[model samples]
Target: MVVSNIISGYQKTQKLSVAPFRQMQSAFDRDCLFTEKIYIIGYSFGDKHINEMIRVAITHNPNVKIIIIDPSYKDEKAKKAILEIWSDEIITPQVENMKFGEFLKQQIK
Candidate 1:
């Protein structure tokens, strides 16, 4: 039920100082390890820790599928960055040039 895991930009330092924040990050890492598919929506891929977690998950489970839904992914630079992170030949993520709402509508249909 608690969706907001990381602290806001103003509280960035608190992320490292707070125990609960560390636990939340650990939980995210654990989930990545077990999840077969990951749907990343509108994430800037700015968090090195989260990016590393996903990389580790893919390394541990090569069969894991990644779906990235963000309009900016249509840009070559943005798309290239994401591909570079999950850069295994077998771990090709399904990149979509659409927003989350649009993706959901298509899925519903």
Candidate 2:
């Protein structure tokens, strides 16, 4: 929530600080670790800390599903890092370079 809300807060203040970054980052890490699977909607996964959490899930929880729906996740480096951390054993979950609505429509069809 902090990550998402930060955008709006920045719009008002036009500035941001690192004071709350650690707390929210820790929360995201905890959620990623505790949850069985993670569904990343619009997140770019550019944050190093969140990326580490994803890697942790991939390495430690093969059963955990990772469903990512983001059109902007086209960076080859990011994709490679994800696949490398995930390895080849676990079946990759749903991922698509499209809007959630469009993706869901296709899924329904």
Predicted candidate 1 versus true structure: per-residue lDDT over 1-109, tens digit per residue: 4646656676564565567777787788888999989888888777666678888988997888999898877567456555757666457778898989999999999
lDDT over C-alpha atoms for residue 92 of model 1: 70
Winner by TM-score? 1
- The count of residue-pair clashes in candidate 2 stands at 0
Residue-level lDDT tens digits of model 2 in 3-104: 553434223322223446556656766777778868878875545445667888676766788887888766774576456555554656567779889988
Overall local distance difference test of candidate 1: 0.77
State in Å the error of residue 76, model 1.
3.9
| Per-model tally of clashing residue pairs | 0, 0
Lowest summed lDDT across 10 adjacent residues in model 2 is found at: 7-16
In model 1, which runs have C-alpha deviations exceeding 4 angstroms? 1-3, 10-14, 79-84
Poorest stretch of ten by lDDT in candidate 1: 8-17
